[model samples]
Target: MVRILQQKQFVGHEIHGKSHKYYPLITKETYTKSFMKGFVRRYFSGSYRQMVSFFTKEDNLSLHELEQLLKELKDKNS
Candidate 1:
């Protein structure tokens, strides 16, 4: 864990005379986006559309659910 933190350049503060407090070098949003990009690349060939299609079909999404999803997408884009 120390090695990983060092490699990732995370800042660590020595506490008392024994342990250390570690802080992330990256923000949570940055880390989550990075993780999701790798996950989608590995599982969905880097295609978000393909991932969403797979999930919709696998879950047997109803027309209303699909429409809701479409509305969400439209709202996000707009």
Candidate 2:
């Protein structure tokens, strides 16, 4: 079965060869800064609280990782 993570752009395809492994790669276009903003908009409502809410509900995000992402977003906007 193929699983699709709506926010995380990807198709989880299986490897035909031995030692099968999968990774999430962006769908459509390359995930540049502009693309990320759109991703954030859809997933986080372009707000800090929204981002927190997203991870809380999804229960798969790490706090430290979110903090780092927040810092990066801030740096980009500033």
> Model 1, residue 41: displacement in angstroms?
1.4
TM-score attained by model 2: 0.35
Per-residue accuracy of model 2 over 17-38 as CA lDDT, tens digit each: 7755666666455556667778
Among residues 3 or more apart in sequence or in different chains, the pairs in candidate 2 whose N, CA or C atoms overlap within 3 Å are none
- Which segments of candidate 2 are over 4 A away from where they belong? 1-52
Instruction: Write one digit per residue (lDDT tens) for candidate 1, span 1-73.
Output: 7767667665455566686676667778987898899999999999998888887889877778889989999
Clashing pairs in 1: none
Against the unseen true structure, what C-alpha lDDT does each candidate score?
Answer: 0.82, 0.69
TM-score of each: 0.66, 0.35
Query: What's the residue-level lDDT of 18 in candidate 1?
Result: 83
Model 1: how far residue 15 lies from native, Å? 5.8
